[model samples]
Target: MPPNPDLRQTIDVAPGLDLAATLGPLRLGVSDPCWRVEASGPWWWATRTPAGPLTVHLVPGAGVVGVEAWGEGVEWLPRHLGRLLGLDADGPPAARTELVRALAQRVPGFRVAGHGRVADAAIDGICRRGVSAFEAARSWLLMVEAMGDDAPGPGGLRLPPAPRRVASCDPYELHVMGLEQGRADEVRRVASHASRLEAGTHDGGAEAIAHLAGIAGIGTDAVEHARAVALGDPDAVPVLDAHRTAAVVRALWTGAGADDTVDVRSLLEPHRPERGLLVRLIALVEAADAADDDGGLTP
Candidate 1:
């Protein structure tokens, strides 16, 4: 055979862009089946797309992010690659404040990555709302394993359930998996409207986020979470769970955690359009500090 060539697209990135910091957020956990970053370097993802399931490989260099893929989703994958890696929006709006300057120095080359697959993003984000990280991860895995199709081009990877698969599920069945009754109902509703949600990604900006208001069960947290990944808002903040909120709070006030999105938004106001990106950078730093066994003193 010669060569098959659906793959197309390259993203010019800053030198030393930390792929791990960028893409780590996509996985539900280190064991998440949707994605992997090899110890040697390359990143791989088994993702759902508007066209279908795709297995994507990303190779990073000094100023470019190379792309390769195989499966039904190939045609649609290239179009959304930029948003997939959270490169859709421009970076910080210029570091004019002291805090901005400090964060810049503290977390150089930090980039937040999100898989801009609308319906899929909505599923993951909605699953995570109002739950413990552990519970959320388990819930997500349960749903995927139970309803998702076998991915076409990768080993040990499962596609996120298609809208039809999810929409057809009985809400009670989902509840048994981990979601509460309300959230389970929300999942079904979202699945029923997956196509519309997917279309919103194309709408972009406030209009897209605004469309979520019509959804009954999707609350502010879920909408914001969906916005982060679906819209590829680099500044998309997803205080993943209370731990993240605690970390952000600890970094700011050196005390207990605060679950107030309003206050957190206020605290991060100076970062402006980059607030979402800023949180990711801080979370990365906090995780690193935790790895050092210093109890993660800073975010």
Candidate 2:
């Protein structure tokens, strides 16, 4: 694909913003082919959009993010860069405790990335229910490898299968990809109604969440996750994961066992609009600590 010079643009970013740190959590894992982070250069992302297949190279400058794109969806990237970089965030909330203050200071560059793709977030959230992270990632990788198309860029990337295609897939085919029958059906249900969901996401606010939650197989948990990732609702608290809950509690309460639903909300309330980003950062820190304990092998 030839680069679209006319589509390229740069937007100013806040100081101390580490582009990698800001966007790293968006990847399913280190080996996620759709989102690539270079060791010393621009980040590459490939996705299927309403316009068409898009590949973007995001280069970070001293106080800006340079975006270059190719393909039919070229205009989407530049227009949505602010959401992607969490530019609208109110930053750290007033820290009521030293722990909260330290967390904010330690990862000042952290930001919640908004992909603005409801189908993608919905599919991911569905696959993750009642499963380990490894299992969810594996299932997603298998489905993408089986049904996705080649991306319009280098690195042999592939875009996730379009919602219509997923909506049409047979449950048996998805079952072969390691999804349970129930989950497979849920995926199909969400995909079949993806257009409506996407439209609702554009409308934004509680209506979108309500519309998504009203769908069969989608619960509050999935809605929360989708809101955070697809809609860029920084206040969206994800469904409770034991590890993530434990991590947060340990960070704040030292010897606490784990965070209950109410406890988690209370802990994050101080951060307000940046709560989702902060939660993700705490998870990242916990994952790093686990890696260290396992002698650098990620759990």
TM-score of each: 0.85, 0.84
- For candidate 2, which ten residues in a row score worst on lDDT? 253-262
**After TM-score superposition, what is the CA distance of residue 281 in candidate 1 from its true location, in Å?**
1.6
lDDT tens per residue, model 1, 1-299: 52343574678877777677778777776756777777767788887766877888888887888887878889877666766665654553255566556776665666555576656677777777777788888888888888887766544477887679789988888989888888888788778877666533445635646666588777676677777766657566763677777666666653355445436676777677777766776777778867678664522
Model 2 lDDT tens row, 79-197: 56666777755454345556546765666776666777766777777777777667777888887887788787564577876777888988998998778888898888888876666
lDDT of 1: 0.70
Candidate 1 — which residues are off by over 4 angstroms? Answer: 1-11, 90-93, 199-202, 205-208, 254-263, 294-299
Clashes of each: 3, 0
lDDT of 1 at 83: 60
Error of 2 at 23 (Å): 1.0
| Model 2 TM-score relative to the real fold | 0.84
Instruction: State the RMSD for candidate 1.
Output: 3.8
